[model samples]
Target: MIPFLSAWPPSPANPTLPADELHVWVASLNRSQTQLNQFWQHLSEDERARANRFYFDHDREHYIVARGLLRQLLGNYLQLPAHLIAFAYGEHGKPELAAEQATSGVRFNISHAQGVALLAFSRNREVGVDIEQVRPLDDGEQIAERFFSENEVAVFTAVPPEQKPQAFFNCWTRKEAFIKVIGEGLSCPLDSFDVTLKPGEPADLLQVKGSREAAARWRLENLEPANGYAGAVIAEGREWQLRTWQWPA
Candidate 1:
């Protein structure tokens, strides 16, 4: 069975969530075949098909483990068995529950970079999360200038050379989280808004098309899921207390 780190059998009797809290679960996707097989037992047929579509064995294994973990968590949250959980996709391929489960008030978003995965959950509010492995990038600056907003580009340009790699991912992950929160995916223009990208700077949305109020409505928090990897979480409200945990190895 996939194991949670601790305290994860959330009390169903007291399922009412605090209005000001969010939970982020960080886990590694790399799993042994035996573990992978156990996870696969919880998957829906459609998910299995998608997993089978991956050409590489590792890619397929990762997909199964990721979806399996997702189902397991949702099951715990909803007090249901893992395979009983159902998912429906949004217009932009964002996954949601069937209309029957809409009243549960559990909002979540997922992102995986390389082998690390992040899952963000909240009650009655939109949430987004992203994780990315840090690696050498020859065209990091060029890509930033082309995609990041003007103000964001300025911030990226001002960062010292040695710190650019981390700063670039900082900006990229924040943008990705926001877009996922909005459920627009990449259909929304990356350059339409700005986000904090410099090292040592507080994580913030900065500005969304110069609307300070719009910017203020969102919150960004840096995530350190593992060394050599960067993560971020953005949501539609402010001052939401964050609680994060990792899956058992």
Candidate 2:
């Protein structure tokens, strides 16, 4: 059987910022497409086909499951009808709300990689989340040199060779989370931003050009998604807290 993480109630010690504040949810899709068909049936044919175009079958299932979970969670959080929680994607494919909510000013973003998906929501602030499964690399250092900034490449290269893949994924997810929050796609150069993601340390903001002052309003966090993945979230404004819910089977 595919193991899944269930949403646990939050504790006072880990109190949510506010009912209306930012929250993050992570879901695992280790189920077969046939098992996920119940969720898939809710989408229009086009949406289902679009999701299916993803290279991996689990990617398709997780995307659909995450959207359904988002709709249900938004209904409870915003006290809006589930159908009213609409979505519209940006020119570069960043998803946003389609219609204004009665609550007003709520924003969210979603991302998935491997078998995991992440959703981030905030009140009066834009948010983005990204997760990547760390995979074995024959030459992770070489790939970092090709795609990462000179400073980032140097950092990875200095990682004693054994820990380079983890270091590379840490940096990649931070940069991707930030870029995803900016909604600029590849137009926002990766080299323009620098992120600090030293192993066992929290993600720190690094300066980047072309990101609006609005982008600076964001708070980014490195996430621990299950055992094999690295993840991060970028949200507008500081003084925010995150609550993660794992979707049930």
TM-score of each: 0.92, 0.81
Over 45-106, each residue of candidate 1 has an lDDT whose tens digit, in order, gives: 98899999999997898889888988887777788888998888899999887776667887
Any runs in candidate 1 off by more than 4 Å, and if so which?
1-17
Task: Report the lDDT tens digits of candidate 2 across residue range 159-242.
Answer: 765566677788888888888888999998777766775677778666666444644676778887667778888876777767
Whose lDDT is greatest here? 1
Q: Write down the lDDT of every candidate, Cα atoms only.
A: 0.83, 0.69
Clashing pairs in 1: none
